[model samples]
Target: MAFVNPEREEIKGLLEGNTTIAVVGLSDNPERTSHSVSQAMQQRGYRIIPVNPAAAGDILGEKSYPDLGSVPEPIGIVNVFRRSEFTPAIAREAVAIGAKILWLQLGVYSEEAAAIAQEGGLTVIMDRCIKVEDSILRPDIRRI
Candidate 1:
């Protein structure tokens, strides 16, 4: 069977309830989409946790973790910026860390990853941009 993302109300609920997001493959470079998206989310009051081996110390004013396992606090969402092929492994890790949501950025989708995350009891969203969703679903949130 094919995978389908949650409905608009469900996605809105996830965004409304979750505050902390772990951005996998987040890059420190301002030119990267991950950086910009995360920054936007942060401006809207979501805590962005940067997870990238290549980037340590701080990216976007938050400490960078090597992987999802190393994040000390509980993560609300695992927002993946990696390619489709890389998402399944990230799904597994997000499950292990008890993340409530698995969000694949626009243009990034994998049926295998969605299945894994859904089976692990996560709210899965694919081929969508969180920043765009937030702006659309929650118009009260100001865009920076």
Candidate 2:
């Protein structure tokens, strides 16, 4: 079966309820899309938790964890910036960490990943830019 993303209203409500995001494959470099997107989310009042194996110490101001399981606090959303092939493992980790949402960034998509997250009771959104969705759906949130 094919995978489908949540409706616009559902996504908007999920974003409104969750203020924290765990960004997997987040890069330390400011030029990377992950960094910029996360920065924008942070500016919009969402907490950005960097999850990367190679990132030096921190990306943005938050402490970086090598994987989702390493994160200490509860994760509201697991936003992945990795390639399509790598998302299944990320989804498993997100499920293990009991995250509510599994969001695959723009150009990233995996049916297997979506199935895994969905079976684990998470709302799965693939091949979309979280930043763009937030900007469009939550117009009340002002950028700082």
Model 1 lDDT tens row, 53-79: 999799999999999999999999999
Clashing pairs in 2: none
- TM-score leader: 2
What tens-digit string does per-residue lDDT give for candidate 2 at 1-144? 788898999999999999999999989989999999999999999999999988868679899998899999999999999999999999999999899999999999999999999999999999999999999999999977
Model 2 scores a C-alpha lDDT of: 0.94
Q: List the candidates' TM-scores in order.
A: 0.97, 0.98
User: How does model 1 score by TM-score?
Assistant: 0.97
In model 1, which runs have C-alpha deviations exceeding 4 angstroms? none
Predicted model with the maximum lDDT: 1
Model 2 CA lDDT for position 69? 90
Off by over 4 Å in 2: none
